[model samples]
Target chain A: MKKLLNDPADLVAESLRGVERAHPELRVDHEHRIVYRADAPVSGKVGLLSGGGSGHEPAHAGFVGPGMLDAVCAGEVFTSPVPDQMAEATKNIDGGAGVLHLVWNYTGDVMNFDMAAELAGAETDTEVAAVVINDDVAVEDSLFTAGRRGTGAAVPVEKITGAAAEQGRSLSELADLARRVNDNTRSMGMALTSCTVPAKGTPTFDLPEDEIEIGIGIHGEPGRRRVPLAPAREIAEMLMEPLLADLDFTGGDGVLVFVNSMGATPMLELHLMYAEIAAILDNAGVVPVRSLVGPYVTSLDMAGCSVTLTRFDDELLRLWDAPVAALGLRWGM
Target chain B: MKKLLNDPADLVAESLRGVERAHPELRVDHEHRIVYRADAPVSGKVGLLSGGGSGHEPAHAGFVGPGMLDAVCAGEVFTSPVPDQMAEATKNIDGGAGVLHLVWNYTGDVMNFDMAAELAGAETDTEVAAVVINDDVAVEDSLFTAGRRGTGAAVPVEKITGAAAEQGRSLSELADLARRVNDNTRSMGMALTSCTVPAKGTPTFDLPEDEIEIGIGIHGEPGRRRVPLAPAREIAEMLMEPLLADLDFTGGDGVLVFVNSMGATPMLELHLMYAEIAAILDNAGVVPVRSLVGPYVTSLDMAGCSVTLTRFDDELLRLWDAPVAALGLRWGM
Candidate 1:
């Protein structure tokens, strides 16, 4: 595999070093493996934290800042972080208010974040809570996940909850808001190609030149179906049909739509897909209030995309528009 | 040929539709094919405009906003825009303070923008000035360019010049700043694979599985050499050595290092590469005062990266830090 790395075993740490040097506004605790906002631990404000496998970049780490995540604990590529990393991160971000963990729904991630929360509860006097994201509509189960796998919606959940937390919400309130946001979001993805795991040193799956895989997971797990490659309009229909059917999207509810690149898909294709998606939503009488089209959440160098729809109202729209200062998504700051 | 578009002919227009819908803060003039900041044509501030072929998402179009380009004119993919588009954009953005055209040093771009300026000069009272960017050091001359091809330095030039324009700098002052930025900046790029132009329905160039092309242009033009694939550190050296040799970079000058993914390169690998770059800079007693690593300027779905270093001073640093609101790079607002 042609990848820009040295000693595959040291990918995560080395990347963190680069991440540390890139953003002075960010404080990278190399020893503890925590990426925190430079001005973190705001007293009396809820602390927001998220962590998952490292391949889905700009997710946990790139989203670390004032109005999104206070700190992010990173694991190895496609691997879960140890409990100590999360525990230390929780302790540091925990001010007098509390800490909240936004864990993506994976067996290892769920278990490890749970262990870290328990350790933080036993070791520190800070209150802790978590909202697990399981928004993927592609499958009810996956290879490494118990239920539906969390996908693109994790980005919006982090942004919305962080905004609420910035407004001085309590621990329980933040948890409830997180759960609400997760419940209202749904995502579906497809892959034209598979990404190679660095350790594997080869592509995870081989795709025929003329065929495409639908409902594929972020990590190359099997999806709902594989079909003949088609135009972008058909692909959008295939992905969005299930999402629209699964969610109770109300007319004039003011929706937020995200067309995310899995990895290698360019913005040209994503925007083309978004144009089709916008037409689909318009035909359904749903007004798209906000639209984000790019690689906010991605698999490593995989050529595909995921579609996410979040039913928006006054509160969610406000939170979505609130100032967020993160590397991945920043506006109004 | 695996791109997400209904018809290859409609790629540019459809993407613009999505672009218009995605950012309500910016206005899309579909007729003339220009992206304008919603509150453009500030009375006393000099107007900034840049444009080129499509496909390069977020380059000219994504750079349009406050403290950046007041307007951007977009052409078809890899094809120069007609003079009418740029002429119309010039007339609209000129608010008594004149307009600055930042053209990349491509034959089509220079020829067409020159025509547009002449047209605007004959028809209206708006004064037009331009500073062409030609910082790619891969070769003194290349495939489609007269001297050198403009690549990553286009990003910093727009940013620095935009900041100066926002400060009410005269048209000539902005032109001088742009020249200074272009003269001090040097860039070199390499590609692991080739990208397919939509209209062509095939890869632009052939790259073998084990061999890579160094010093590639954004349009997939041939580079200086094709070498056997190497590790990220060695590749970093290959890229940085040429850049260092091309310019007189100093220790106390305060550097702005931009490691840009051509397209399709993941952030993980980019960060990993950045680690190597940071170490190389440190060993040379140089500190990167600012760093931007991602797909800011891209060739459509090409798997490669480019490195750009801008020897920075207090003026450039202040301009870089200036707040600009655009979709691609937005912060400090």
Candidate 2:
């Protein structure tokens, strides 16, 4: 694979330099591998911090801004940021109010953020709250692996919960909101091709050109089943079937839909899938109140899309309507 | 290419449906292919709108939010959004305060945004100001291509301009600010691997595992030259030498450095590259005011990195310090 990188070893550090350089208001604590808004210690506001593997752009770091995450700890590609990085980030961004840790379902992210919170609570007066988003419906509740991968649900969870924090909600309130959003949201993704990590320089999996992997995880994990490329309607059914079975989108006022690209899927196709998914929902008597189609969250250039449904109530909608400023997911100034 | 999409035609619509479902605060006009903040036409504010190809997640569209874009027009992957989309986005977001069209240097983006502005002007009292960001220092000024490709410059442009817009700066002033940022900024990228567009599920360009392409454009376009993968320091020199020559970073009070990942590059390597880039700028007598490293604007999951520098004035710094809330770029509150 021909690439445009200086060196595999230098890729991560160089990218961080670029981020810090572009947004001077956002400080890159290179020593700690954490990113924070330059205006640190945003007095009297509960600081929200998150971190995860580096490949997911705009997930943890891109989300650092007002009304969103206060800091983002970045690890190597596909690896969670270390505890030290998270600890420093939490400390740097923590205001007198408190701190909330929102992370995805990945084991690395969960464990690392937990460690950082522990370290943070021991050292500072900052109270801490943590929420893990496990919204993927692809993985059933099983004992073998962590059940359900967190996919598109993380985007809205962060956006809405971040807004709650910005509104000066109590730490418990923010944590509750995060937990509720996580509980209501369910996501399932499919992959057409495996993406190559820069260091690996090869496809992550051997997917035949004519086949597709259903229920693929964000980290290039194998899906529940590999199937031939099907029509949009059928594929939507395949994705939605599991999600519908997992949750009752029918007994609610409506559900929010997120058609997320797995990095490489274009908006043209994403919208097409959206049309079909909407039809499927309509057929199933599921009213759609809100929708998000795009690569809000992604796997590196993987040719796939994930469907996330979050059944929302009035409070969730109000929180969702709150203004947020981040690198992705923003509205209501 | 085994893509997980149901049908190639359904891709975009499905994705947009997901976007709409996921983000309740953003209004998605699937037919028009425009995404707008639900509270657009902000009563009295310059409507800031920008967009382009789809694969660059968190760009153009991901940037729509408070303190940033009022709306975003998403095009097909690697292709500029159509003029109609931009026109609709402009009209939908226009609040009788006029509009500012911030576009990148791609021929398609420039032409389409211009057409949209013209169309928008014909129907409404929406005075439109256009500014094109041509910050990539990869290509020397040439007649053959649209100046230097706007690489990492879009982030700062959107950010500073968004701040100006939030401050209630008029359309013309926002345009001027964008132009000033463009003038002061320069970027150069190197790719370690060619990225595969989702529709075309193969490497855009074949590259041996050890080879890298320097002076690359954002959209998987052929770069100025291909070279063997080198040490981070040497690669930093290779990218920065051309950028420094194009613009004198020396004696500048301080410089903002952006080490952006195209995608697929890890954060670990980005920091190392940042250190190397800092050394290069230091040798050139460029004091670093700030640094950013991440995959802000990306080309699918392309494995590459770009370095961008902006010589900042106090005004620029203040604007940079102003609060911004968007899905893609956010900073001071």
RMSD of 1: 1.4
Across B117-227, the per-residue lDDT of candidate 2 in tens digits comes to: 899889776788899888887775533246777768888888888878878888777888999999999999988877777677687888787788888777877777888
Best by DockQ: 1
| Clashes in predicted model 2 | 89
Q: What is the TM-score of chain A alone in each candidate?
A: 0.98, 0.95
lDDT of 2 by residue, A247-313 (tens): 8877665777888877656554565677778888888888888776666677766778899998988
lDDT of 1 by residue, B224-333 (tens): 99999888899999999988888778755589999999888889889888888988988877779999989988999999899999999889989998998888888877
User: Once superposed on the true structure, which residue ranges of model 1 sit more than 4 Å away at CA?
Assistant: A251-253, B251-253
How accurate locally is residue B223 in candidate 2, as Cα lDDT from 0 to 100?
Answer: 75
Best by lDDT: 1
lDDT of 1 by residue, A185-275 (tens): 9999999989989988999998888888999999999999999989888999999899989987776458899999998998878888998
| Winner by TM-score | 1
